[model samples]
Structures are given as C-alpha cells and as structure tokens.
Target: MAHPVRSDAEVLSVASEGVYHRLVLSARDAAPRVRPGHFATLAVGGPQSAMLLRRAFSIHRADVEAGTVELVVAERGEGTRELARARPGDRLDLIAPLGTPFPLPDGPVSALLVAADYGSAPLLALGEEIKRRGGQVGFILGAATADRLYGVEQARALTQDVLVVTEDGSAGLQGLVTDPLAQAVKAIDATVVHACGPMPMLREVSAIALGLGVRCHTAVEAAMACGVGICMTCVLPVVGEDGVSRFVRSCTDGPVFDGARVRWDDIGTVPPDLEGAAAMGGQG
Candidate 1:
C-alpha cells in the first residue's frame, strides 16, 4: 500500500447529476497514487462548523496527468450537503488513495462489475483499468429509481453489455439487480465479479457469483468515525485465510475485500466465534 497524502485540494467543479453530485478536486499528489477502489476523506463544514469527522468517499475517477480526483456524492446528511454545496475555488483538507483497492487480473479475462446507486463510482474506474489491460468488462447498475441510477452511459461507452435495473420499473429492468445476475454471469462466461453497494445488495451479489464458481470482490459501505484506522467504529468480523474470524477495520484493512471472507450476516455485531470476542465482552 502506498502512503496516503494529505493536502488542501481546491474544488475544481461541483456539477449536479440528478440527485447526486460530481465533485472534481485538484489533488496533485493524491491523484497519481490512486488505485481503482481507493477512497479519500475530506474535512467538511468549512472549519467553523462542529462537524469534525471527515467524510469518506470512493475515488470516482483519478487523472494523474490532470492532477485531479473526482468523487460522487449523495446528500444524505449535513456533511455531504456541505460538500455538495462546494463551488469552484473553494478548498478543503483531503487525504487520498486510502484503503485497499480492487485487485486486477493478472491477464485479460471476462469480468462482471456490479453496483447500486452511486456505488457505481469506483467500479467505473475499475472497468477502465480492466479494459486497459485487455480484459473484457460488463456492468450491472441498480437503484430505487431511474434518477438514482448512475453511469449508464459511462458503462455503455466501456462495454456494450451494460445492464440497468431499477426497483420502480422506470429503467432497464424492474426488480433487484441480482434478479438477472446469474444469467448475466453465465451469458458473459464471467470468471470474476466485482461489486460495491448496500450490504444487502452486496451479499446477494457475492452469493450469486460464488454460487456460479466465479471469484468475487466486494467494496463495503460502513460508517466511519475516522477515515484512518484510529477509530474502531468501522471494525467488522472477517474470516482470515487461516479460518479464524477476527475484527478488522474497514478503513485500513479494507473498504475492498474478498466477498467470501467477509462475515456479512455477522456485521454490526461481534460474533461469539470471533478471535477476541470472549475477551471483548461478547457473549461467547
């Protein structure tokens, strides 16, 4: 892993996209270091507000030549609302290229990328990397409605096999994105699957891919008090290769991890079988 760079990035642009916002920042040192699934943390609320916790966002796109990084923001709370309101020329403290990125294949192979809502952010970048390496990529983007679905055109530009699903039937397909996942995987003869979304959606995507004997990688969305590893707020149960379950910090250990290794059902609570659960006061 590369060391993170902390710098004051100037807001290059904040363009509205339906209910989401695309934020471009001038991050010279950080942009060059970014990998597909890496994220960045920005101190929001303009220094005067009491909001001290930094807001973590996945790196939507990074341009090393342009010396810039982009983020996809959904205004779900005050912190994000502040970020969404940012205009050109404003500056914010930023730490970039944090967390583990989605691993690319050793050679060209067929792969399927899955996402929901703005979760498509990182996967879009991953698709570009895969294509650059001579691999074929497909995308499945889902959301509650048409407006919420992102990167439809972007996915189409990368690959002709882009699939969109919206729960309300306002888009490509009606129902969950997973409804067509298995078929899509088989159709494309996918060897690997990469996903980013809500926990439930990711769980289903992982299950579908693994059931079909395809390798799966998932980027999790967890609440973080600190984007760095200092806070324990984002710790979750994950089974290691040695078959022991331990609590790992999502911010540092991963925002990206093997889908099969994560204890999805045991998330948000320490399982009794965890390595230090008994000592940590868990009901063992």
Candidate 2:
C-alpha cells in the first residue's frame, strides 16, 4: 500500500467487552501500507472541548484495496470513551501509517513475540508479517487472569507455538510470561525477540535479551497529548552513538526502539523539576 494522506474513516464493528473496535478507512487513498507496528492517530470530540488532540492507536489490520483499516483499542480515558460510544456509522478523523516499523529479521530464524494484556494488538499483525516472510513465530502472552487475556486464541491460529501465563493461574501456565519466554530462549536458538507490554515486562525482556546476546526490540506505551512529535510529553532517554545520553521523542523517533539503546534504568526516575533535592538524595 502506498502512503496515503490522512482522512476521515468510519467505524465498521465494535466487538464485545468494549476492548476491540474496527474502523474502515479508504486506504486506496493511503500513501503508505499500514505495515506491522505502525500506528494511526484518531481525533475525537468537537471543537468546544479542550481535549482536541488525537489519540494514537496501532493499526491492527489494514486492507488497501478495500480502503479499510482496523484498530483494537482498550477503552481507558476520555478519548477512548468517546471512541467506544461511536456507532458503526460514525466517522472519525484519522492520521494513519505513522511511526517506524519493527525491523523484520532476515533469514530463517526463530522469533519470540511477547505481549501482556492489551499489548497483544500490535504483535498480532507483526506475527503475520514474520510468518509471511518464512520466519518461525513463538508467542508468549501474559495476562492478570484468564478473563483479561484476549487474542491468544487468534495468535495460536496464526502460529503453532503459543504460550500463555496468567497471574492467578486461571488458565495456561501459572506465572509471568517472561518465565516461559526465558525458557523458550534457553531451549531454542531464537534470532530475535520483540515485545510490547508494560514497562516492567519490557525491561525484563530487554535484560534477558542483553544477557543472551540477541537482538531485541520493544514498542513503548507512553502517555501522549499529541500523537506527533510536537509535544514533548513522550520523551524517553536514549544513548547516542558516541556514548552520550539524550532524550528522544517517542512520538516521532519511535514508539518502537532498540531495547539495548534505551536507558531503561533511569526511565521514570528523572525529575521533572529540580525542586525535590531531598527526594533525589533519598533515592541516591
């Protein structure tokens, strides 16, 4: 699919549980193919509201010929609430095909994809892409319990190896997904590891990848007022090539980043202001 300009799209279906919704946009006019890991920003509310910014959501599915795109959004905030209230006929303004994609590893290699809870949305499309390119896909899904787990069945349909770990032992393995992921890495010769979930989970996966000496990439979930790089809300610490450290905008530089390149330890520790001298000392 060619990169098409952003346009207004209509809601196609709203699934049960208020977590997944599908939108159909005319992608024939889209300039770029909505590749795996790419996202789109949807504008909500009328001009009267102060919350005029667009909410970024990963492209769950894209069909260029049908001019359609789908997004699986978990209703969490005001923007998402408005989106959930939208009906099949409702139209939404969309800025799509945004951000860089997760790099597809070359050659026939074993790959591990990990997702926790709603984080599974982005990985679903990515799994399909990897399979299309003749790469073996292994999925490690983590959820608090059986009920919260979504898309595992779908993922299993796409890939032969699917492992599930629930916090409460309601279903699948009773533990963190990272446990099975660690076991998989040790048991198999995986070439790449890709993950998108909570910060803690990503950090754990990153550490494992580092220790294993394999390539790992993570898709970050940061709070953003603006989906584009205009706002500095989603700035993340990054290490430069010359061993220097800097902050990069997650909106533009990435929502996806090389796990080894990010300074995960100091991620949320940075002070917004220098006012908390005592707190800094306490942490030290």
Using lDDT, give the best candidate's number.
1
State the local distance difference test value for candidate 1.
0.92
Residue pairs in candidate 1 whose N, alpha carbon or C atoms collide under 3 angstroms: none
Predicted structure 2: lDDT: 0.77
Which regions of candidate 1 fall more than 4 Å away from where they truly are?
282-284
lDDT against the true structure, per candidate, is: 0.92, 0.77
Shift in Å, residue 83, candidate 2: 0.7
lDDT of 2 by residue, 1-284 (tens): 21435777777666654245545554445434677777788888966877878898877777766778877777788988888778787777888787776887675667888888878888888888788878888888888888677688889998778889999999899999788776787665777898988788898899999889888999888876786778788887777676666677777777788999888887865534323435655774
**Which residue pairs in candidate 2 have backbone atoms (N, alpha carbon, C) closer than 3 angstroms, thus clashing?**
2-31, 2-32, 3-30, 3-31, 3-32, 4-30, 4-31, 4-32, 25-67, 27-67
> Which tens-of-lDDT digit does each residue in 26-112 have in candidate 1?
999999899999999999887688998999999999999999999999999999998999999999899998999999888898999
